[model samples]
Target chain A: MARLSRLVLERLMRYYRFLTETAAKEAVETITSGEIAEALEIDPTQVRKDFAAVGLIGMGRVGFDVCEACRAIRVTLGFNRSYEAVLVGTGHLGGALLAYPNFVRYGMRIVAAFDNDKQKIGQTVAGQIVKPMRMLKPFIKRRKIRLAILTTPAHVSQMLADRLVAAGVKAIWNFTPTGLAVPPDVLVRNEHISIGLAEIAYHLKDQAAC
Target chain B: MARLSRLVLERLMRYYRFLTETAAKEAVETITSGEIAEALEIDPTQVRKDFAAVGLIGMGRVGFDVCEACRAIRVTLGFNRSYEAVLVGTGHLGGALLAYPNFVRYGMRIVAAFDNDKQKIGQTVAGQIVKPMRMLKPFIKRRKIRLAILTTPAHVSQMLADRLVAAGVKAIWNFTPTGLAVPPDVLVRNEHISIGLAEIAYHLKDQAAC
Candidate 1:
């Protein structure tokens, strides 16, 4: 089967959100790629292709059952279950990411946070108390958390990722300056601030020139 | 010409980053869709199709000039430049995101930060001091800064965005729950957090099910 594109995954998520919001008010048995495109300002062909990647077939005129499509996307994206995860580096960036209200809502939990800071070691942020870095392996084993978020300084991202992987993490959302080098089986998503800023800078420059 | 796909733009940004880093150290000439796919583990056809969207032509085996392709992608992404922006919500999140090393490296600058609180208003972060919210418009106008990074609270986002728009903000990277409705001409990219968390939760569920 063809892999679902990130663009498709993103739209599927958006469509799922809209459908849920719509479901609260009314029964939606069918949906159309056109409607999704019009609402999201995305291309209909892209939407169709995304759905097709998931092996879903929308009805010709009747469209897709809104709930069904949402379910399918969720299942494909591994969203239909709950995931317990740990966080390393409970500093500002980590705190902000943990404060993001969507984690638990999406079935991902930050059950514990690890830090070497003496002051922060026992304190709680976003309902997760910080644990000493030494306790990482045991914590992961006990909690059965497979995902980790790294908000450590750039110099330590690789080390932090290694720590998490050693503790049995399969995926990591890295917010450090240094990107990690991990095995192919592990998923690493680098949320680089420089890249985002650079893109924005380029846009602002163009806008100014225009 | 067909518009460039977002995925291509994203990859282009990554490629640009790499080239900017290696351009001085190495003299490279060409790139192939297959090479890019191999490096990123993405589909080769996907690379070709994305490039075609922007009218970037690569020969069968000869591929494309690395520098030229880099330039083409940068132009396509409007990346031959930089942008100056402001920071709001001088709390932990605001401070850390501002202190992020990625911004300047990528091409964006946060020239100033504004806060309503007296304690934080005069403090410095990322070498830029926090200014009172009252000075926002003047600072923005003087710098001709159009993009704003908003880390304000949900209850305040609307009013804050309004003030920013009134001060001539053309784009916003919102880091709050409140979705500010703006004029179509003014671009608003909501880093809609709750939505992000919800998506995570949904993914967790799917993974757990698996």
Candidate 2:
């Protein structure tokens, strides 16, 4: 298989989501690349390239098998297997992610949650008891948890990230906007919410101009 | 000015953020596009093109004035002025976004929050009292709110979106996974959290393969 660019992979995932949702709605079996492109508002050529990169082929104009395409995407993105993870910071953002049902569907499960707030510590959130931040190291080490979902405040994000990495975390899904300086050996994904908002704001600009 | 691609504009926003954060940290007043490219991991040529598209130029060697570049980006993205927006769900995600202080920094303010939950309707989240869903229409009309931040459940998303649009919302910042079918005139931005996680999972696969 060819090495897919991050943009292509991201679009493929979006296509997969569209396909899966369509399939769930009724009896959708196959869908054309053009239809996916139109739904995603992306060019057809780019969708075709992404399909080829993922080893998914459409039958001329008949389209692709929905199940097969989804399977291929799941396999390619490593979402076919579940990974146990931990969440730090039981604030609203952290609580929201913990309650989110789709993370399990995408193969990442939050098995534990931690917070430094005395009032919040020991409370149950999303069926998991919120533990004190001091217990993070022991819990992660004992369970061998490798993934950390970080929603800590920006002021303490880097410091907490260092602590997570030192406690045997290999991946950090950071929701905070703070830039973390994790080691090369550690994987970090920053989900800056402001960037998404800015995208909408830009489009809104176009709307206003018209 | 040339029409910028959505991807380019998004990258420019990221660069603007990097520049602003760096400026906040030090006495830095100027920066090379090359340094911005390195920090963002984007090609230098692409950054140059993006800069030119926004009518910002750098000296042969002295680089660009950080303040000037930021102003250009802010103006182009329409982030220079504040936008009054409302939240439609007071759940965890809604509450988190409502409490997000950075939204103000980005020129958006959540003026109010609405939820159908009887227990939450009169309560305050992020300093805004959660109103009943019944009050959404009147409040939007009375306040002349044009922007909506939707964090409602998937089942009721489309229905509520229709109501929001009918109430004169021009744009929606959707945090739900469900696809909305709003009129062409109404803009919708879906921030699906799963897609971000899948991207991280894909990179994790590469790490494992290595």
Best by TM-score: 2
Q: After superposition, how far is residue B22 of candidate 2 from its true place, in Å?
A: 2.9
Which residue pairs overlap in candidate 2's backbone? none
Q: In candidate 2, what are the lDDT values of residues A135-183, reduced to their tens digit?
A: 9999999998879999988889999999999998889999988778889
- Share of real contacts kept by model 2? 0.66
> Mind giving the per-residue lDDT tens digits that candidate 1 earns over A179-204?
57887656776665544443454445
Assess each prediction's global lDDT (C-alpha) against the native. Answer: 0.72, 0.85
Taking chain B only, the TM-score of every model is 0.86, 0.93
DockQ of 2: 0.58
lDDT of 2 by residue, B1-210 (tens): 666776877888888888898889886989988898888778988888888888898888888899999999989888977778989999888988888888876778889899999999899898998999999999999988878999988889989999999999999988887778899988888887777777777767777687
* Model 1: residues with Cα > 4 Å off, grouped in runs: A1-3, A24-32, A45-69, B1-83, B89-92, B114-139, B152-166, B176-210
Each model's fraction of native contacts: 0.34, 0.66
